[model samples]
Target: MVNGDDNNARITNGNLAEVGQFPYQAGLNVSFGNSSTTWCGGTLISHRWIVTAAHCLDGAESVHVYLGATNISDVTEPGQRHFIVDQSGIIVHANWTKSTVTNDISLIKLPRLIAYSQTIRAAILPRLVNGSYSLYEQQTAYASGWGRDSDSSDSVSPVLRYVAMPVMPHILCRMYWSGAVSEKMICMSTSSGKSTCHGDSGGPLVYRDGNSSYLIGTTSFGTSMGCEVGFPAVFTRITSYLEWIREHIPDLP
Candidate 1:
């Protein structure tokens, strides 16, 4: 979904809701000077850090982050100011692949620590040490973005859109992808047309375990069939990369 006005030009089959409007949703816009280039989805994992897909960065510098915003067109609010990332400390997964979407996670360190607020904060990362994640069958997860709503369209959404899907069994997912789906990936989808899309890359796939919302995955890729046909949507499992994430940001739990 596109997050700004219709005239902004870029479009896809994804959607986005305003920041702070949804606790599990966050807006990710990459702006170079006066013009906003591309819009990807992200999850606020801390007061200052955001977790997204590495392919979204694609070796760009001097990016601005917008928090506490409901609409990309409207950024005049007090808490919705853009912050510059500390380029020196930025880290993208060393094994990230451009051809295939593997190890697609990256972290952005803000120059200054963001003050905790209702509109901006971190989401919990799933625990890697947890006994087992395969015990559940009906595990539901949420994904938000501003990409296209369907495969046929390029027009992005003005407001963020969300969809709930069930986690696909690892065995089934691996079988479909010829075991390409690794330990670092999480698969999700529905039997109907309900799932994330092309521009939803880097967005969070969140699920609730016990009392907290855990970021289980980051939107990566899916088949050309789009969100239909129950094709598994792949994501970078946050739990699999917890050590790498924490090594860069020691304060994150």
Candidate 2:
């Protein structure tokens, strides 16, 4: 599986994103040195770093990152920039556990600094309240990726797609997922068949606070049942790893 069947990824029942709509979005092609390639999404947090899911780098070797392009296949897209990175640049969280899906965040270093443009920019990370996240339940957040459009699809979407989903209370999500839910995770659920599926792992879940958008979550996992089954889509809470992120990307703005 590209994004792995074990970990949920992608956007189902989403709208095709316009060029430049999500300037911080990044499409990743991961190669495992055996001609095996998988896809994942990421967010540009700074000119030299991208934040993504640790699972996305599991058993991976190299990554080809595409920035500022909705269409991954189009190399000629005006604002798009491509960079190839080896495993040396991939940084998975020290406590990341694949079995429990805990601490599922990672940071990738760009080989060189990138210039920001209208179609290429970094996202704002949330400001912690007393060293922790403030509840934003009931607020609408947007998830964007180039993952599969449906559960049955074997390939990833050709264009970037996004869906608007409302954040669910942690208590409610815990009730649904039982012990699988953790404080380091955030969740969103919808009844309209809008959710992440395979190939969207490591993608961004953005929350707009006032006039600025915050990179609140990174695509983690969803129910094993399916994407549209009224289950909550889980993400690695960015707010919970601020200090970890700062430790890695010291120049983070």
Candidate 3:
């Protein structure tokens, strides 16, 4: 993946997603004050709230959100819904540090509540274990987005894509990122030529526990060198911000 404010993170070496495959996936077309448009990914945590990376909202004048669509451009796609939000509805974390990409999470409030269907729904939040969020090192998780298909690609994918990655140990992640990897972040093991490339920022890292899938992480950043360079991709650990999230969106489901 690329920088948080850069529209480069994407699902490199991933598979095309089917309709209703990622009901919680949200495609964002963020427009800046200068009229430049950038792409980003988001997760629907509730009918009225969308969770994404704070950097995605940097200088964002407006956000065009597309839900329930495999092809973001297909407005007539079955169950597709669209909504527009401005800065008034956006909320960036107070502690978000753009320099280090720390606490790179944010929430977007929809103008109106959306009805849930088979193709549109909220993602499940993770449950705490022993008063702390559970960590799942070595476990597999899925990341979906409409970001770039490759590091060299300038355009993001029109259709949704996803990849399966394994969770790596925090210590191992720290070894790669050094002190840059904080306890508030989660890392996914990377393979050669396989990663979340540019345009994948703010997407969900979902883990399946039993029959339920929980949102574990939000795409933050990958190595500046490139997404497929074997360094673990860092994410804003969703579990680490459960309290913060609940405080903002008290009715989270």
List the global CA lDDT of all models: 0.67, 0.88, 0.86
Q: Which of candidates 1 and 3 reaches a greater lDDT?
A: 3
Candidate 2: where is the Cα deviation over 4 Å?
Answer: 1-4, 129-132
Say which prediction, candidate 1 or candidate 3, comes out ahead on TM-score: 3
> In model 3, where do residues sit more than 4 Å from their true spots?
1-8
Estimate the TM-score of every prediction: 0.82, 0.95, 0.95
Q: Which residue pairs collide in model 2, if any?
A: 9-197, 9-198, 10-197, 10-200
Q: Which number leads on lDDT?
A: 2
Cα error of candidate 2 at position 205, Å: 0.6
Tens-place lDDT digits, model 3, residues 107-219: 99999999999889888999878876778899999999988888777788889999888998999998898778899999898886777868888999999877677899998
Q: How many residue pairs clash in each candidate?
A: 25, 4, 9
lDDT of 1: 0.67
Candidate 1 steric clashes: 25
Mind giving the per-residue lDDT tens digits that candidate 1 earns over 1-253?
A: 1121221111233345545644545556664444446667778887778888887765655556766665656667655657666456457788988666678888877777777676766778765355754422359887777677765676556566777768888888888878777877888855566767656678888887665778888887776544554566778887788888888889875
Instruction: Estimate, for each residue in 95-171, the C-alpha lDDT of model 2 and write its tens digit.
Output: 88888889999989999999999889999999877866776788899999988887788788999999998999999
Q: Which lDDT value does model 1 have at 57?
A: 68
Which one wins by lDDT: 2 or 3? 2
